[model samples]
Structures are given as structure tokens and as C-alpha cells.
Target: MTYDPTNTPAWKRLLTIETMFKEGNERDRLAREAAATAASFPRVIARYLTDAGKALGDKALAVTVTETGPRDDEGRSAFTVGNCTVCPAATTEFWETAIYGGYESDVRLTVTEAAQGAEQVVRRWAEAHATRCRELPVEG
Candidate 1:
């Protein structure tokens, strides 16, 4: 299955722009220090998804990302692959590596902990993706 961050909703794109932070002064710090550039956000997401797709293999990729849409929880939408969600937990569902940020932000999510096996892969990919995101220097 093919992956495209552009397929993500508009709301999630906005959230993705701001969700990367440590809050308080760190938000300010990131705004100033992480000034990596913004045009690459979608490219970054697409690259991460591509790499993850390869790592997990074709069958797993086909059954998950390409075949499904983000699921809604309450008023929020969650982007899922297999049984795990990978979206920001507010507004609308969109592709995101925001597995942990939802817990910190006011956004509410359905799942948090990373389990064993496949779930573990999803969890670790999110963590790594989040770290790589630090390179983007997104402006809040």
C-alpha cells in the first residue's frame, strides 16, 4: 500500500505544526532554536511512513495504512494501523507520530501504552519519528 501525508486532513496538519513542544518556555525555545524549516513537514511524514512501511513489510502495510481511514473516538478522529493509533488526539484524525504528545496536550486519545510485538513496532516508530521531528524546527 502507498502512503501519503497529503491525504491527511487539514485540521491535523495544523495540529502537527504546533504539537511539538515541551510547553511553557520550551515552546518559545523550540520556536527559536528548532528553526529547521516548515516546507518539509509533509515530506518528513511521508518519508517516515515509507520507511515504516518497508520495515513492517508489504502485507502488514497493505492491511493497515492503505486500506483504512482514521477512526473516530468521541468527537476526535484517530489515524490507525493494525490496532494502534498514530494521530494527534484533538479536532480531527490525521496521520501523525504524535503517540505521546496527545497525553501531554489537551487532546484526548483512546490508547497510550505500547504493547509487545506489532504494537511495539508502532510505538517505537512513533518515538523515533517524534525525535526526527525535532529536526524540522516547526514554528509555533
Candidate 2:
């Protein structure tokens, strides 16, 4: 599938923008930061969904975030964001890459992670989407 950050939920978009501005060279640190940021996006979406209730699935929104590298198996860490409601979820496997005598590493996540990640992401999206959906003024 294809990964499009632009179409991500608004709150998620803010999270990604923050992550991009963050400064870090360590793969784990960056992944942790990214995961934390991603964790928040879903919460925001869920909050809105809870408020909106019924209007959800009709305009269901999903978001995805992916961080690639920092590898060699044996308990390596990966980071990513996934949302299908707004755009198609990705479908590539995450890969861990090691480089420069272990001085540098990258976390690569597959599109499939979107599937695994969606469950959590969607719940969060629903909550927030619900809230926002309720607030939308009647278009009639």
C-alpha cells in the first residue's frame, strides 16, 4: 500500500510535525520519542470519536507514522504510525539496519505494521473523531 502523512488525522499531523523537529541521532532514542508522540495522536482521535459517537465510521479517519532502522534482531526496537480511515495503510516489513561500526542504526517498519498498529490507532481515532464529529455544525 501507500503511506501518506499529509492525509493523517489533524492531531496526528501535529505529532508528526513535532517529531520531525526533534533532534536526535540515536536510533532507540528517536524511536522512543516517535512512539511517544504517536501514542498521543491516537488518544486525541479517540477523544473526538467518543464525543461524536454515531458519526464515526461514516467519516472514519485513520493515521500512520513509521520510523525505519536500528537493527540486528535479538530484541531490536521499531517505531511507526498507521491509519486507514484517511489513507491506505502501508504494507512493507520493518527492517533494522546497523551501520558505522554500530555508531549509527535505523528502524525500518513494514506496511503490514499498519495492520498491527491500526487496532490501537483506530480506537484512539474513534474517541476523538466522535467528539469532533459532534461539534461539526449541521451542514443543512
Candidate 3:
């Protein structure tokens, strides 16, 4: 005998189709948002890098800006310059910051709590360390 979907209730079939449509729409919306975010990333990162430079002051040119991206859920973004990576600390206030990587050192700075402008201070420190760091990343 041929397969028969009629064995299933009409309302159940309708519900299944409706669920599929809702899932598809949600996926499409997420894809669109991701695409828009990716497209705008370069400009956004450039602005952050520019801000990092201003924070760097006379040492601005010493560090080479590299990769950058957002951590939206954490309410922060990060960028790597030279051998170091810097990002805002994940806290309730989002006032703290963290920096990782250094010259042949597994250096990390994590602040559980901080006053305002802590991120700026971390950025400045990260930039300075990046300038002097000569350690290259190891390839897998």
C-alpha cells in the first residue's frame, strides 16, 4: 500500500506546517541580522581602532591593529593588535576589562570590579604591551 498522510489528523498536519514556517522565518531573520552585522563590521571595527589610537596617545603607531569582532551577548567587542587581544570585561557594570597574550608570556588581566573608564585604561595597557611584544602565534 502507498503511504498515507491522511492517517495523521488534519489539525496536526496543519500545526506541523505552521511550525515549519515559523522556524524558517526565524532562521531567515537571524541570517539577515548576521549578514548586516558582518557587512557593517569593518566600519565598526575601524571606529573602535580609531578610538584605541586616541587612547594610545603618543604610542598610537607602535601597535599594529589586527582582527576585531563583537561579542553581542556579552555587550562587548574585541580586537587583536600585535600579539595581544583586548576586550571589555564581562561584568554587570561592563566597566572592567581584560587583556590576553604577551611576549612569550601567557599574560592576562581580568578585573572583577572596576570604576568607570577601566576599559580605556585596559586598552591603553594592551596597546603598549602589543608594541613591545615580539612573540609570534604558534601554528597548529
Candidate 4:
């Protein structure tokens, strides 16, 4: 039979279907673009520990970078670099490596006594993870 949609319910149904497909395609495109942008640029977190030249045994330093968008199940934005704790050795000039926990994974560097460039290493790790991680944080 020939399909006709003049003043009929099929017209509305067709319109609805079209709209759904269009919206879905647009959403996919947006997601792709967001992923590309994220891969291209790493998030920036200020270096407070090394920049200030704080002495060893001072207060522990934490460097975190929260995602700007895309909330989690708890309606909170994810942390690309979260819970990064850098503690200075009590009796040594070296700074302890940072332990970082994020939405995607947790990393603990083996370099306990990072004598030089410890802050830079931690910062680079955070920035690198921030660029690649897209998962949202989950409340645990």
C-alpha cells in the first residue's frame, strides 16, 4: 500500500523518530569532540609544593584537578587527578613520591625518596592522567 501522512498520526510518529535520530547523532558527535579535545590538552593544576620551596617535614601537599563537566552518579564532577598526597621526608632532604587516586585509577610511584624533580614528576603524572581520563567519580 502507498504510505500517506497528510493529517495523520504517522506524520507525528515520523517526526518524533526523526528528531530522536537527529538528537542521538548530535550527542554522539559532541561526545567524540569532547574526547578529542581532552586527548589534545591536559588539564592544568598549579604547582604549590615545589614553587613555594616549602621545607621538608612541612604540611603535606595535595594536588588535584577536577573535571569541569560531566557529573557522576552523585551529581558531582569527577576528579582527573584526585587525592594526590606529597609528603616530605621528616629527616631527609628528599620529598616522598605522591600517591594519586582518581576516578579511573590509582597510582603510587615507587620512588619514595624523590630527591630531585619530585614535584615535576607528580605534576606531569597528574596532567597526563587528566588528559586521558574521562570516567566520572563514584561515591564509595
Candidate 5:
């Protein structure tokens, strides 16, 4: 369906939305590019973490990935990656700050709520599974 934003009374709203649409479209393009760049992070981090674990003789903390959310009101979606649960490695706020650093605009705090949730779930997992620590082979 096509949008009928033309009949709206507020000229500033229309202009602002237009500007936002233009900027958001650009940001979306950049996000896709960033995702392409980000494709290497998991493999790299996993390798590093595994190597570190092996070096320190620490048991590898297995992280499982799953889809977080496509929670959208206006057809926008956000994704997260975590240990089976949806905890983002780096958050929306981090990305926004990284992207729009020089501007004085308000930074939208999407991660505050999601990070809180992730933290709660992580806490629960640690508490519930505290007795089950996997031991690695130790070298003398």
C-alpha cells in the first residue's frame, strides 16, 4: 500500500519525515554493508576465544546463536546474537554512536531495554547452572 502523507497538515513533519526517509534509506544501505563486514567477527572471535581457552586451559564457553526479534511497528526490525538467548554482542546504541558521533541529536536507547533483558537471562543462566562447570584438561 502507498503512503498518503501528502494530506498531513504539518509541513515540518512532512519535511522531517522525508529527510528521515532519505537518511534512513542511506543508513539501511550502510547497515547492509556493515553486516557484510561484520560477517567475519564471529569466526574471528570464536577462533581467538578458543585459542585463548586452549592457552589458558580454560573450558570453552559455548555460545549458541539464534534469531532474536523482528519486532516491528513501522516495518523496521532489529536483530540480536547471543548464547541461544538473544543477547547482542554489540548493541544498537553502540552502532548509532559509532555512526552519528558528531551530531548533537538524541541517541535512541534501544539497547537499554534489550540489554537489561539479556543481562537478566544471563544472570539466571549463571545462577541456575552454577554447579555445572565443564572442566578442561590441564597441562603441567
Candidate 6:
């Protein structure tokens, strides 16, 4: 356990701080992520699928490499889905901002790795899922 002054008891905090600062054994890896923020969060890598026909629930799926940092400054990306009831019955419409894409959080990966992982998830999910909206047969 880290002994952050603010997070630990008065005595343990100082001791932990001394141990970390003096020995550098438990130094938190905050330096690497200092500049990272929600607004400035470099995506590193991502995968996307444009709805074009609004077939997918949300125009596209935002398959992105997940990283924890900064804060929830952006709140959350707005998302929407297409109406499936109409299918071939009538025209349907929907709007969305960002779609859900499974994240790889176990290990921090290089940009290339992140991109590959993201695309893999996007493709897998997109292929596995089915679209309810279908075109009706044209009259001969």
C-alpha cells in the first residue's frame, strides 16, 4: 500500500513519504501521466464504424484504448440508437455521439498494439451483432 500523506494516518504518511522519497521504492508513477487529461487525452489509437445507413444502433462504435487519468471532465459522450421497430416497415432515424467499444485495460500497450486491439474488438462486436433494419423486397 502506498503511504500518501493525504491518504494515510499522520505518522504513516510521513514514514511512507520518507521511504518513497528517500529510497524511491514506492514512488507513484504519476509523473508519466501528469499532463494527461480528459480533454487532452491522446487517444493513442481507436477504431470506428460509420453508420452511413444508420444500420448500427449508434451510427458507429468507438473502439478506443482505455486509460485512467485526469478526471470525468467531459462527463460522458452522448450516444443514441436507430429505431429497430420499423425494420422494413418504414423509415427510421436515430442520433448518437459516442458508441460503446470493449476496452483493453489489463496492460498498457504501444500505439500499434492499441490500434490492433481496438479494431479487433470493433470488428468482433460489429460482426457478432445483427441489424434489425432490413430492406423490403422491391416489387417486380
lDDT of each: 0.35, 0.40, 0.42, 0.41, 0.40, 0.35
Regions more than 4 Å wrong, model 4: 1-4, 41-140
Candidate 5 TM-score, true structure as reference: 0.28
Question: On residues 1-140, what C-alpha lDDT tens digit does candidate 6 reach at each position?
Answer: 77666655887878887887966633444433444444564332323333323544553332222322222323333211221222322111111111122342544444434444444544444332323224332337
lDDT of 1 by residue, 1-140 (tens): 79777677986876666665436568787556434432222121221332334554532221122112222223222343332123231111233334334333444333332111223444455445533322221237
lDDT score for candidate 2 against the true structure: 0.40
User: Which tens-of-lDDT digit does each residue in 1-140 have in candidate 4?
Assistant: 77666657988888899999999999999889777765654344443332212334333343353233222112222233333334321111122222232212255423322212343444566544434433332338
lDDT of 2 by residue, 11-61 (tens): 698987778766444667968876766565322222222232244454333
The Cα error of candidate 1 at residue 45, in Å, is: 20
TM-score of each: 0.18, 0.22, 0.38, 0.31, 0.28, 0.23
- For model 2, the superposed segments whose C-alpha errors exceed 4 Å read 1-106, 136-139
Best by TM-score: 3
lDDT of 2 at 49: 23
Model 5, 54: alpha-carbon shift in Å? 13
Global lDDT of model 4: 0.41
* Sliding window of 10 residues with minimal summed lDDT for model 4: 88-97
**What is the total number of backbone clashes in candidate 2?**
44
How would you encode candidate 5's per-residue C-alpha lDDT over 20-80 as one tens digit per residue? 9999999999889666645534321111122334456544433332223322212233333
TM-score, cand. 6: 0.23
Per-candidate clashes come to 1, 44, 1, 0, 0, 0
User: What root-mean-square deviation over C-alphas does model 2 reach?
Assistant: 22.2
Count backbone overlaps in model 3.
Answer: 1
lDDT of 4 at 75: 25
